[model samples]
Target: MNDFLELVKSRQSDRTYDTTRAVEPEKLERILEAARLAPSACNAQPWKFVVVTDKELSNKVGKATSGLGMNKFAKDAPVHILVVEESANITSLLGGKVKNKHFPLIDLGIAAAHITLAAESEGLGSCILGWFDEKEIKSLTGIPASKRLVLVITIGYSAKAKRQKMRKEKAKVISYNKY
Candidate 1:
């Protein structure tokens, strides 16, 4: 996947992973670097990435993500990047208030995208998980209760094959100048 569009097409939510393998430190560092370089409104960079690699702790965090028959595969993933929302800079705060938009959340979303894409480029599969026990995870990670954990990204060598993407047609989603 040298081409960017092809890379985008190939990336998917990988639910099954090869648990025996561990993500290399170099590759993980590059992925984190990509997230660090993600753009933010007013360059606030209002987020923190908690990279979880320890087997014992990862299992606990993964267990917290599983409940109500959802995200059971998270426990098998070798790496989990916990995205913690942080305070935004003054400029981003004022701009968001004036525009009636929450820029930090949006900024964090962009960072998540960067992380997943970088993981793909490193030949690793990733899944962005929004459903999890936030309180339990916070306690495990020792994160402040006040801060919000926005996303938990699982990354590892995928055990499942790539499936065709099901999406709406471009004609239905795109427009020239008018709605």
Candidate 2:
């Protein structure tokens, strides 16, 4: 998986994980560092990664992510990285207002991509989860209610095999000049 395109092709939203294994601290730290170095608009970096590694706490946070038959596998993952949305710097805020686009959300999305990709490079599986009991998770993690919890990323050894990716034809998705 040294090639960047191959790495992108190999990365998937792994649903099942090997419960007995734990992610190495060094690997996790490197993954966080990758995320920390993710580029942001105006270098605001308006996000915080709240890592949950303790068994009981991770399980609790995972449970908060499960309901309606979604993210049931989250509870089994060994680690959860909670993506907390923070306020952007004044320049980024003004730029976002001027452009009518929320840059922090985009910045956080890039950070999440770095996190999952770094996990994949480290031979770990990761899933970015958006559906969860935000208030409950915020309370569980001691995050202020005023702040938004954007995403929860689960990381661990994958138990499932990779499936061939299905995508639209290149012609349908790619264009030469204009739409």
Candidate 3:
């Protein structure tokens, strides 16, 4: 596989993280920079990323990501990145309303993807978590009520070995010209 394809294939969701291992500052900065450079609709860039490294705060944020045994591994992650959704620019907002689309949400997703890819390139493990207690997380992070918490990314060293990735054949997922 080509270098880009290999990098994409190697990236995976890692829930089991090495609690003793901490992410390097330079690596985290690069990941954040990648996310910042992600493209947004009309370049509105309606997003904010809050990085949580404090152990106590991380535990609280992790608790918000956990319930019913889901995302239990988040509690052990050394870094948590909160992707907060902000309102888009006037043009993007009007375009979204007129076109019946939520551009900010799409922009946030793109940014999150950039974050994960950058983390993988840095040799760190990451998991994009959407299931979380928004209220609890907001209280812990002091995020404004106006901003919506879109995604929480857990970053750390992988404690578990990589498993082979499973995917449908390209023929099943892609089509040429017409559907």
Candidate 4:
């Protein structure tokens, strides 16, 4: 497989992370760099990332991310990245209104994809978590009340082994010119 294709194939949501292992600073930097380069609507770049490395804080954020048994594995990860949604630039905002879509959310998703791929490339495990207490996380992270808390990505070395990828048949999901 091509390098990028191989990376994509290998990447999966890692729920079991080794608590003893710490991600290297250099690798973390590269992952963040990849996220920073993610494409955004009209280059508006309406996202802010908060990386939590402190054990206590990571635990707090992780616990907050887990609501009603959801994302219970997050507390074990060594790092948690908060993807905050910021105001888009004027052009992107206008385009979003005209297109009847919120471009910032799309932009944030793209950024999160980049981050997960990069973490995989760096031999780190990652899981993008959305089932979190938005208001609690915002307060815990000291994120401005006006900003949107979009995603929380847990990262660390995997304690569990990689499993085979399961998916629908390509033919079933793909289409020709018309759906």
Local accuracy by lDDT, each model:
0.96, 0.96, 0.94, 0.94
Q: Give the clash count for each candidate.
A: 0, 0, 0, 0
Ranked by lDDT, top first: 2, 1, 4, 3
Clashing pairs in 3: none
Question: Over the stretch 135-173, how does candidate 2's per-residue lDDT look in tens digits?
Answer: 999999899999999999999999999889888999999
Task: Score residue 19 of candidate 4 by CA lDDT.
Answer: 92
Worst ten-residue run, lDDT, model 4? 133-142
Q: After superposing candidate 3 on the true structure, give the runs of residues whose Cα lies further than 4 Å from its correct spot.
A: none
Clashing pairs in 1: none
Q: Which whole-number lDDT from 0 to 100 does residue 164 have in model 2?
A: 96
- Runs with alpha carbons beyond 4 Å of true place in candidate 4: none
- Give candidate 1 regions above 4 Å deviation: none
C-alpha-based local distance difference test score of model 3: 0.94
Tens digits of per-residue lDDT, candidate 3, 48-80, equal: 999999988998899899998899989899999
Candidate 1 TM-score, true structure as reference: 0.98
**Model 2 Cα displacement at 86 (Å)?**
0.7
TM-score, prediction 2: 0.98
